[model samples]
Target: MQTLEGMIAPKFSLKNEVGEIISLDNFAGKKYVVLYFYPKDSTTSCTTEACDFRDSHEAFTALNAVILGVSADDEKAHTKFIKKYGLPFSLLIDDTHEVSEAYGVWRLKKMFGKEFMGIERSTFLIDPTGTVIKEWRKIKVGGHVEEALDTLKKL
Candidate 1:
């Protein structure tokens, strides 16, 4: 993946669960963004990571940050996952993987001894001015949200 710090985050306009347009620009000039890329929705690790973020959403908001999740899943799938998990934040559907490639999170992975292309769980914190303040790649779900929150506070 490319180093994105000190660089402007790639702007994208994608559909959310309700098919509403959600753009990287939407939160610009107003709030910090927690732009996260995950392999899929509702998977064990993804679920844990998302729930952790959801649980700590108030703290994130208090820090003037908004969480936005991204995956190759479509709007329908995102809706199902959000409903099933009660995810508080919007899940952006990146069906074409354009945004994923721009962020450099889509990569080759080996799981169960099988190689495949997938998203590497990663999070990027973009400041209000659109510059990336921090990024966490190949994230482990445990205590990760708190760490991200702490980073946001510092920013």
Candidate 2:
């Protein structure tokens, strides 16, 4: 809930779309990690954001950054979403919501006068050293990828 910038990122190992386990340590000292937490897969905003990342995948790779999406979606759903959108990045499955809690993105949200617990849609930019360098909480999908990309450019 507080600023994670300059702090060591929360270490995690979760299953990706293909059922491969992925850990934050995997990117440490290798590439900057763009770990983004979304609400769900195949939803309108999520799909648009994922597609945006897909479109700019090359630029991020060229900058030595790996984009990882996280949500409570299961492996099957993630795989389908990736296949449908042709996502070029790994989408970590946070089925237990532990990772979201660690990152402080899991909180009470209201929609249509109904309150419920869900992800707030956040993104953390972790440098190769595993320190969180930049973060955006309660993110709006529009122009968000560009904002994240620009921040990485500064680093």
Best by lDDT: 2
TM-score of 1: 0.96
For candidate 1, lDDT tens digit of each residue in 1-155?
A: 56999999999999898999999888889999999999998899999998999899999999999999999988888889989988899999888888988999989999899999888999999999999989999998899999999887776
Tens digits of per-residue lDDT, candidate 2, 83-144, equal 99999999999989999999999999999999999999999999999999999999999999
lDDT value for candidate 2?
Answer: 0.95
TM-score of each: 0.96, 0.99
In order, what is each prediction's RMSD in angstroms? 0.9, 0.6
Q: In model 2, what is the error at residue 37, expressed in angstroms?
A: 0.3
Q: In model 2, where is the ten-residue run with the lowest total lDDT? A: 1-10
Cα lDDT for residue 54, candidate 1: 89
> RMSD, model 1, all Cα superposed?
0.9
